[model samples]
Target chain A: MATEIVFYDIPSSLPNKAWSPNTLKTRYALNYKGLAYKTVWVEYPDIESVCRQIGAAPTRNKPDGRPHFTLPMIHDPSTGATIADSAKIAAYVDATYPDRPSLMPAGTVGLHRAFEDAAHPLIGPIYPYCLPASHALLNPVSAAYFRRTREELWGKTLENLTPAGDADRVEWKKLEDGFGKMDEWIRASGEGSKYLMGDVLCYADMWMAAYLLWLKLVLPGRWGEIASWHGGRWGTLLQNLEKYETVL
Target chain B: MATEIVFYDIPSSLPNKAWSPNTLKTRYALNYKGLAYKTVWVEYPDIESVCRQIGAAPTRNKPDGRPHFTLPMIHDPSTGATIADSAKIAAYVDATYPDRPSLMPAGTVGLHRAFEDAAHPLIGPIYPYCLPASHALLNPVSAAYFRRTREELWGKTLENLTPAGDADRVEWKKLEDGFGKMDEWIRASGEGSKYLMGDVLCYADMWMAAYLLWLKLVLPGRWGEIASWHGGRWGTLLQNLEKYETVL
Candidate 1:
C-alpha cells in the first residue's frame, strides 16, 4: 500500500550531502510528516536535464524570462504525481498523504505560502554570505557549475560576492539587522514562540529551519554568529527541529 | 449584556469623520468582529493628554525615544481594560469576547503579525502620498498639529514632502511597484483570493483594508489609481470588506 517518495536534491561534499536551503525545505517537510522518501542527489549542472528527463515542470522564469527548473521537487509513486518547486512538493505530499502528519494544516496552506513571500527580505540577502562557502563545499563539477551560473547571475566573482575585512562585518550586520524584525513577529506569537505559527510546526517552520540548516552546513564556522544574532532565536529554532534533521 | 467599547479615532473634515489609517485598523477590527463600539473622536494634539487621562499605555516611542501616545486605543468598560495599539486592541478583544467572531484567530496571530512586518516595505512608502492630503482633510487645529509634527519628522515642509509634475509620477510608480510583491503574496492565497488569508478573513485583512480606507477617505480621487494597481486586486480587497465599513 506504500511506496517510497523520491526527493530530488543537489549533492555536496558536506556531510549528509544536502546543502541547499531550497531542497532542505522539502526534506524537512517529509521528515516532519513521517513520510517515507529517498533522496536522489542531482548535481547543479544536471538539474535542468534531470528535471526535463523526469518531466518535472520549471518553478519560475530566469532573468532572461526563460523557464528555470529548480529542486526540492518530488515524484510520489503512491499518487503517481511529480511536483516541482519546494512549496508545490510539500503541498503535493501533504495532499497525497493526508493520513500522515500535516506540514501544512487545514486553513494554513495560504498563510505558510505567504510566509515565503513575507520572508524574502530577510532570506533574500543571505545568498552573498553563503555563496562562496557553498562553492567550496561542492564537488568539482557542481562547484564549477555553481560558480559559473551564480557569477553570471550576480555579475561578481564568488570571492568578491562578499567583501573582505570590516566591510564584511558591515554586510553581515545588515543581514543580522533583518532578524530583529522577524523576532518581533515570532514574539507576537504569544510571549515565547519558536515556530512561525503558534504551537503547531507547519511548513513555515520547515521553510525557516531549512534555511538555517543551509547556514549551519555551508557556514559551519560562522553559522553560530547568525544563530546567536536575535537573542539566540535562530539557534533555538534549529535546535528544536533537530529531530527532523534526518537525511533519509 | 455587553457594554459598548469606546474606540478612539482621529477626526477628519471628510465625511464619516475618520481618515487615519492607524486608527482605522482598530475600527475595521471592531466592526468586523461585530463588537458594539462607539467612536470617540480625538484631535491630533489631544492624543497624548486623552490617552494619559484614560490610563491607556503609550503604543510606541517617538523619535526622541520618549513614549508616544496614539489613537486607535480602546476602552472596554466591561473588563475595565484600556488597550492601546491596533494589534493589541484586536488581540484583546478576541480574547475578551470569545463569543464574538475572532479577528486574529488562535494560530494565525503570528503569521498575520508577520504580515504587518512584511507589508511595511509597501505600506511605509505610502505616507508621503497621503500626508499633504491628510493635513488638508483634518480640522484646522489638527491640521496645524499634523503639519508641524510631520514636517518636524521629515525635516521638510508638507508641500515639499511630495514632488509635483512628472517627478510625482515617478514617486507614484515607485509606490505602485510595492503592490506587485504583495499581489504575488496575496495571489498565493489560492485562486483569486481578495483577503490576506484564504477562506476566513482575518485581522491581516483589516490591516490592508484599513489602510485602503484611509487612502480612500483622504485621497479620494487618486485612491482609485492605487486600487487599480496589481490588476484591480486591491480594489477587490476593499470591496469584499465594504460591509465592515460601517462607522458606528
Candidate 2:
C-alpha cells in the first residue's frame, strides 16, 4: 500500500507556491523516494481546520477558537503523524523512505550543511510579500486576492504585518543583497560543477530552483541579472519541473 | 588511523559559539565518529593569512593580498578539500565518516531539512550581539583578561556582516515571535519524546541547543521564557559543552 500524504495549499500565499523552494524540496524528495501522496488545495481560512485534521495545529487558540493557523503542514496517514514546518516534514519523509533516491548525499555532511545554508536565506525576504497589507503594495492582483482571501478565510481585515506607512524597501534591499551573495556563490561554485554539491542534484539545487522560480514569478524583470548569472542550469532545472508545476 | 581534520579559529572574530551551531554539529559528529583533528588558533586582524593558506577566502585583496577573509573554513586532509561554510563543513564531516554514529539519521532527508529551518533564523538576531559595537551592550566583560581574550579572538568589528542599527528591531521581533511559535511546538510535541525527532538525539536538538546557548550568552534575560520552556534538556545540553565554552 502506498503511504498517504496530504499537502495543504493556498494559491495566493507565497508560502503557497512562492515558497516553492521549500515546497519543491519536499516534492522532489517524495518523487525521489517514489512516494505517492494526495494534494489538497485549501482556501486560506480553511487552513486552521486542515491543521487540526492533520494534528499539526499549534496547541494555541485562535480568536475563533481554532488552532493557530500555518500552512504547508503535511499529514502522513500511514504513520498517523501530521508534521508542520517544511524542513521537519522533509526530514521525516527522507527517514521513512531510505530506499528511495536520497535528497541528501550519501556520506558528505559538509555538502548537507552547505545545502542547508543555501536554503535558509532563500525564504527570508520573500515572506513579507505574502501579507495582504504588504502584498497590495507590491501588485494589485496580489492585494485583491489577499484581501478577498482574508475576508473569505478569516472573516476580517488582514492584520497589518507591517505597521502602516512603513516602507519595506529596506527589507527588500537586504533580500536583493542576499540574492547577490547567492549569485556570486553560484558563479564561484557552479563554474566548476554541474550542481551546487558538485556533479549531482542535491537539496541545494532544489532550493535554489524553487526560489528562483518564485522570484521570477513575483519579481519578474528584477531577477534578470541574478538569473543570468546562474548561467542556464537554473532555468533548465525549472524547465524540468514543468510537469510538477500544477502541484507547485 | 584517525582521519585528520583542521579547525581554524580566530580568538575574537570567532564564529559566535552559538552561531557555530553547524560547527558544534560537526564537532559532535567528529566525536560520534571518533575522528581526530587538530585545532589552530589564529588571532583576529591576521585571520586573512590563515584563510589564504586554505584558499577559501571569499574576496580578492585580503590583508595578505590574497582575497576576502572568512573564518571557520576547514581543510579536510582526507579529502584534500577546502570548504568555508560551516554547514557544508559539517555535512562533509558526516559524509566522510559514515561508519561511525551518523550526524544525520539513516534514511531521513526530512530530519536534515528540519534542522536547517530551526537554525536559519538564529543568525539574524544573535549576530549583532557578537559584533564589537554591540559587544559592550550585550557582553560587558568581567574585566581585563576576559575582555582581552574576547577582543583578541572575535576582532573589534565584523567585516563580512553588515552593521545593524535600531531599524533591525523589526527583524528582532520577528525572531522573538518565532521562538514563541517554537515554544508552542515543543510543548505540543514534547508529550511522547525526549527529543524533537523522537527518542534519540538528532541534528534538530543540536541546532536548537546551540542557538539557545548563544541566546543565553548574547541576549541574556531576553530568552528566559523560551529557556524555561526548554527546561532541563536545554540546560543539560549546554553543560555538555563546558569544554567548548571559550571557543563558543
Measured against the native two-chain assembly using Cα atoms, what DockQ does each of the candidate structures obtain, in the order listed?
Answer: 0.54, 0.09
Residue-level lDDT of model 1, residues B181-215, one tens digit each, is 67776676668676656677888777877878877
TM-score of 1: 0.92
Worst 10 residues of 2 chain B by lDDT: B134-143
lDDT tens digits by residue: candidate 1, A1-248: 65898889998887689888888888888898898888889988889999898898898999899989988788888777888988877777777778988887765666666566677677766898788988998999999999999999999999889767997788777677766766777778876776766677888877877878888887788887888887898898899888888888
Candidate 2 residue-wise lDDT, B34-114, digit = tens: 677766655445556677767774634544565566556778787888777555665666667777665555433333544
The candidate scoring highest on TM-score is 1
Docking quality class, candidate 2: incorrect
Q: What lDDT score is found at residue B1 in candidate 2?
A: 54
Listed in order, each prediction's TM-score against the native is 0.92, 0.51
